[model samples]
Target: MSTSDRTWDVIVIGAGGSQAQAMLAASARGGDVSRWLAVDRAWRPETKATTEALGMTTTALDVLTSPQELRELLGSGRLVANLAGPYYRTGTVVLDAAIETGTDYLDICDDADVILPMFERTEAAEKAEVRALIGMGSSPGTTNVLIRAAVDYLGSAEDVDISWTVDVNDMTDAAARHFWHCFNIVDPDGTIHPAPSWEQLERKTVTFPGTVGTQEVIRLAHPEPITAPRFLPVTRCSNFGAITPIESLVVAWSLAFSVDAQRPRPDLAEVTDHAIDVFRTYRETRPATPRIGSGMQIDIHTDGNGLRFSAGADTEMAEATGVPAAAGIVLLLDGQTPNAGVFSPETLVPADFFTALRKVSRGGGGLELHRLVNGEQTERIRIRDLLSQTAATPA
Candidate 1:
């Protein structure tokens, strides 16, 4: 289909926290107004109120069991930004419908199971001429892009390391809950398996830039395990999760372990209710505090003679995670990405995409990049030029 015939520039499915940020970014791009639509199972009063406050429109949609309905809703939109999560549970159905309708799709999915299945279905997507971009959120999202960019910087990165740390105090209830659910689903076998991102690193301890001091980090099963190796042919690649105050890390570890233990025999209704209660409690208690409750740090290390690169953002966990996904969709809508089937964030986005995202900080959010050359550190605003070749796409 031609670009102009694409009626709605984008159709965002699900009005969750991430979708809100994506929709807002899409609208802010200075295009023809009224070219976007927000669809969700139920009308979120809070989101509805916020959209009305900002002068946008939202429609109700359930893409899971309603393929016919979703096809009608998709109509001639060129892209669909999906923010529904725990991806293992709800992602496939919507993606299937999009593939069937030949609509390019993007989502912030961080589940390995989800990625593996999607990879299995790549042929179908290709056959339908659809592009499915997955894992566009923070750790798996921007972090994927960073590693790709960094690998391109090094002539041929034989070894790569990726690590992430979040200051939990800054996380919103919704963000924290989404994270907790991912942990639960990944470790449901009741085993604290090594992180997929860190499986190959012999040494897992490194100091973050800006004097955060040295801390030990370990690879866990995150979305990166599935996405990174596809783009970068590194002998070793690892991803980790860390938090400060030690206590917060302990609590996160405990909660993850508990979920792993209970998931197999979980009482679905009870678990859902408990999750809701926890989210509500976190929302009420955390944001009022003066401390910078949550922030994220990302580090990427390479093999051979190459500079190590790290980048991060200080903001609420939700924004840290959501903003990048939104930025990715904006790039896709603007035709910045090539028409490819079943791509990941790192595979499709350019280094400048991160630059643009960093420039447009909402709610006091900021991004910082650090480059270490032969143990000498340099700080910079734009790392795209420094690492452009690493993330360059083959023609």
Candidate 2:
């Protein structure tokens, strides 16, 4: 099974991560596993076993150093599902490799820094006739696509607010660290601009349909605010996230304070791993299954007119991120997404892509889209219903 000799329908980078696991699960469920390949620097026994069970194959070609290898690995028209992250460092390299290879690309990148630069490659991707979709994860991906739908369904959107809350049960070492790093990035605001992870907390209430009611969420630096403004017509766009059980906020604040103030702070991964170890001890002393669960929401508003809409889903963190990514990759490989240039999920994928994501995530508690008229809830539709309409309509 040599990549140089044969092309692949979808090649998933980073075979060992949680996002990869979810992508595999969604791909299997959708029966899109044929001709799939998983690539990593080194093959893990567990990942190999899982890929075997799913009828997928694995190969080793670490792109970290030899990014140009993608040219030989993926040829023109092939699609690469890049699940590797801490994307501020790795996203662009893989993207450049994809462009140089004339391959289509999609990733679950959530870093604003990574996304902004990738957008600059629009001309290069366009010239190469390759399509690249960035930030295709839950918040930035699903949330981004939902905002596009809301704007089209209601009218022009003046504001878009994205919020996320994960259940305590979904906590993982990698996720803990990823969440930690998101809080400490340098965000400027007239010299007093404190990063969201800088202990400067703001309290706001958020709801997840049929599950969570109004719960307090704190500000966090997420990529949606950075990319949403570029694609959607809006004056305000921001993202907030909180872990359920809420006490985790204290842990994050304390850890981030040390990392921010230390002269030689440990690398983000090291600090995040240590934080997870501490959290594990705390977890063992308590019972499993907290009351609330994981979910995310997108609030879209029209300024001064009081017209608004909110949409979201309640699910485990991995499914929340992976299902949407899997759907995006499927769309790209199947030629369902029409664009051939670098773009955000909101800018490139159509409303039908959101419909596809809703279907992909249906078993994971499904999705809900709601409308607010004059600051009050007006219309609510299950994602399944929306898809039914799409199905019934004639093409």
TM for candidate 1 is 0.80
Best by lDDT: 2
For candidate 1, the 10 contiguous residues with the lowest summed lDDT are: 194-203
Which candidate ranks first by TM-score, i.e. highest?
2
- Candidate 1 residue runs with Cα over 4 Å from true position: 1-3, 22-33, 53-55, 170-174, 181-218, 261-263, 266-269, 275-290, 293-305, 355-384, 387-395
lDDT of 2 by residue, 279-357 (tens): 7676566666545766567768875333333433456778778998988876776667645778877764445675566
Count of backbone collisions within predicted model 2: 1
Per-prediction backbone clash count = 13, 1
Model 1 over residues 195-242: C-alpha lDDT tens digits?
222234223565654434465554455767556666666555555656
